[model samples]
Target: MTKPLIEITNINKSYQNGDQELRVLKDISLTIDEGEFVAIMGPSGSGKSTLMNIIGLLDKPTSGNYDLEGQEVDSLGDQELAKVRNQQIGFVFQQFFLLAKLNALQNVELPLIYAGVSPSKRRELSKQYLEKVELVERMHHLPSELSGGQKQRVAIARALVNSPAIILADEPTGALDTKTGAQIMDLLTDLNREGKTIIMVTHEPEIAAYATRQIVLRDGVITEDTRKGGEI
Candidate 1:
């Protein structure tokens, strides 16, 4: 069997608000194998988002372990963690988080720029991913010029431009209408079919059905985990 691309063993996270310590995660452990699409389902205030942040390496856990592709990462310093995040994980959000000032291609190139890649290489890579999302013709279009679905497509391309080991999507369809959301999910499913490991957070069961595995979180802990056989 293939080794897991992401591993969390007995993980926990907490935050302090005005001298009040609020625990958000509790002894959670999970593994995501490469190319396996999974959905994390939880109501508001559950630890799902916190887990996603940890998996994305955006926040350090208060305790336990995170191993990414066989390396212990929960203990890495901020700088090394940033490096891992830049080169290893891609993020998609419900907000479409694009810069209003830049065109589609420019937005997709931002990660490469942060990684200190050359300008010419950035352009080539960004354009290649734009093509993958069928947005080659709209590369120069700004976020305001694109429709909701188009913008999400551009976001997907941006997430893929880095070719990271995993994609972390937080409510990716929350901002779109039903039809557009379905289209976006189709695109994500296509990406997964092509062997990109995708872990997404969603509250909609219909949306979760697109994934091969489902995990439910409640009160800062995992409550249920399910796997669908045969096909995604």
Candidate 2:
């Protein structure tokens, strides 16, 4: 059998709020194979975001194991985890999360800068990704200067700059209207068809329908895992 690109094993996480202990995740386990488009759906406080964070290595689980491309992530130090995050994971958030002061080119170049890529190389690569997202002409536009769709396109370019193993998007369409959201979903679907693994967290069933697989989480555990035709 082919190994999974992403794996989570009995993961658990909780937080302390003043004198209270809130259990955000309770023994969640999941696996994502290569070239798959998966969506996670849940209500508020259902721990979908927490699970996404652990998968992206943005935060450590309170307990249990996680493996990325067969590397035991739970055993990695902070620096190692940072390296993994930079090289393997690309994130897109609902809020665009662009730097207000930086133009599209510079914004997409941020990841390369952190990865020790030279200035010349950063420009070249950023331009390539910008063009892929069809935003090369708007490279000089600030986030505020772009419309909702354009800004999200720039965000997608930034997410692709690193050629990451998987794209993790949290409520990627939450901030957009229906028409714009469908356009963004089509872009994502096209990307997945070209072999990028995408795992998105969303509450809308219409958004989740774009993915080949759907996992429903409730009360911090997966309640159902469904797949489309031709999917395993």
Candidate 3:
């Protein structure tokens, strides 16, 4: 059998708040196979974001075992973790984090820049992804010049430029109108159909419906897990 793309076991996350220990995630275990589009749903403070951060290597679990592409990662050093993140994970968030000073194409090229890619190659690849997202016409426009949907598209292009193994999106549509949000979801669906593994955190049922599998979290625990047809 092929190894799962992500394997997380007995994961826990905690933070010290004044004199008390606040536990956010509790012994959560999950496995995501390659090409699976999974949506994580939860209410406020349910630990969904914490889990996503751990999966994306933006943060570490206090105690757990996490394996990515069959290799253990929980014990990797900061630099190693950064390398893995740059090579294996792409992130999208509700707030488009594009630099206002940079144009769409330049924002997309940022990751490649950190990866030590040549300027010419970075521009070429960034252009390719921007075109793929149908934003070629606006590639030269800055984030301030684009609409909410357009800005998110530019962020998506930036995320895809790295060719990461997984895309982790948190509240991707929170700031857009229904129509624009639908368009973004369609783009994500198309990417997933093209075999990219996506793990999105959303509170909207309609948005979650775009994914093939849904996992609901409440109070730091999974309460429901369903695939298509409501299969658990």
TM-score of each: 0.96, 0.96, 0.98
lDDT of 3 by residue, 196-228 (tens): 999999999999999999999998988888999
TM-score of 2: 0.96
Which residue pairs come into collision in candidate 2? none
Q: How badly does each model clash, as a count of residue pairs?
A: 0, 0, 0
Could you give the candidate ranking by lDDT, starting with the highest? 3, 1, 2
Cα-based lDDT at residue 2, candidate 3: 44
lDDT of 2 by residue, 1-232 (tens): 6469988888999999999989889998888999989999999989999898888888888998998999999788999989888888898999999999999999999999999999999999999999998889999999898988888888888888999999999999999999999999999999999999999999999999999999989999898888997434
Off by over 4 Å in 1: 230-232
lDDT of each: 0.93, 0.91, 0.94
Highest-TM-score candidate: 3
Model 2 — which ten-residue stretch has the worst lDDT? 223-232
Residue 60 in candidate 2, Cα distance off native in Å: 1.2
